[model samples]
Target: MRLDKFLKISRLIKRRTLVKEVAEQGRIEINGSVAKASSKVSAGDELTIRFGQKILTVKIQDLKEHVKKEDASSLYTVIKEENIQQPTRHE
Candidate 1:
C-alpha cells in the first residue's frame, strides 16, 4: 500500500494530506531512507517519523486496505519514541 494510505489507515497520521505534507518536509523515512507520500510500503518495513519535538519509529507489521478502528494499531509496532530539543534534518 501507499505510505500515505498506510499512515492514515494505521491511524499514525490521521489524514492522507497530512502524510503528504509531512513526507514532503522530510519528516518521514522508510527503512532508513527518506520516503515520499506515494512511496510503496510493505510488511516488515521500518518507518522513522520526526514530529515537532519528538521522533517515532515503527515497524510495519501488516498492510490492510481496510481495518477496524480497534485494529488499527495492529498494522504497525512501535519500536521507539523519543523527545528532543531539536530534530536533526539535513535540509
Candidate 2:
C-alpha cells in the first residue's frame, strides 16, 4: 500500500492529505530513510514519524485497504515513542 494511504487506513495520521504533506516535507521515514508519499510499504517495515517535538516509531504488522477504528492498532506495533527536547530560542 502507499505510505500515505497506509497511514490513514491505519489511523495513524488521521487524514491522507496530512500524511502526504508530512511525507513530502520529510517528516516520515521508512526503514530509517526518508520516504515519499507514494512509497510502497509492506509488512514488517519500520516507520518513524515526527510530530512536532514528539517522535513515534512503529513496525508495520499488516496492511489492509480498510480497517475499523477498533482494529486500527492491529495494523502496526509501536516500537517506541519519545518526546525529545529541542533547542529553544533565546538560550
Candidate 3:
C-alpha cells in the first residue's frame, strides 16, 4: 500500500493530502530513510512520523485497503512517542 493511503486507513494522519504534504516536507521516515507519499509499505516496515512537537514511531503489522474505526490501530504498533522539547527563549 502507498504510504499516504496507509496513513489514512490506519487513521494516523486523518487525511491523505496531509500525509502527502508531511512526506514531501521529509517529516516521515521509513526504515530510517525518508519516505514519499508514493512509497510502498508492507508488513514489518518501521515508520517514524514527526507531527509538530511530537514524534511517533510505529511498526507496520498489517496493510488493508479499508478498516473499521475500532480496528484502525491494529494496522500498526506504536513503538515510541516523544515530545520534542523546545528551547526556551532568552530575552
Cα-based TM-score, every candidate: 0.92, 0.93, 0.97
Minimal lDDT window, size 10, model 1 = 82-91
lDDT of 3 by residue, 1-91 (tens): 8999999999999999999999999999999999999999999999999999999999999999889999999999999999999999999
- Model 3 Cα displacement at 56 (Å)? 0.3
- Which sequence of candidate numbers ranks them by TM-score, best first? 3, 2, 1
User: What lDDT tens digits, residue by residue, belong to model 1 across residues 1-91?
Assistant: 9999999999999999999999999999999999999999999999999988889999999999999999999999999999977656997
What is the overall TM-score of model 2 with all chains considered together? 0.93
Candidate 3 whole-model C-alpha lDDT, 0 to 1: 0.97
Candidate 3: lDDT of 40? 97
User: How well is each residue in 30-88 modelled by candidate 2, as lDDT tens digits?
Assistant: 99999998999999999999999899999999999879999999999999999989778
CA lDDT for candidate 2 = 0.94
Higher-TM-score candidate among 1 and 2?
Answer: 2
In candidate 1, stretches whose alpha carbon ends up further than 4 angstroms from where it belongs are: 86-91
What does the lDDT read for residue 63 in candidate 1?
96
- Scored against the true structure, residue 33 in model 3 reaches a CA lDDT of 98
Give RMSD to native, each candidate: 4.6, 1.4, 0.6
Q: How high is the lDDT of residue 86 in model 2?
A: 77
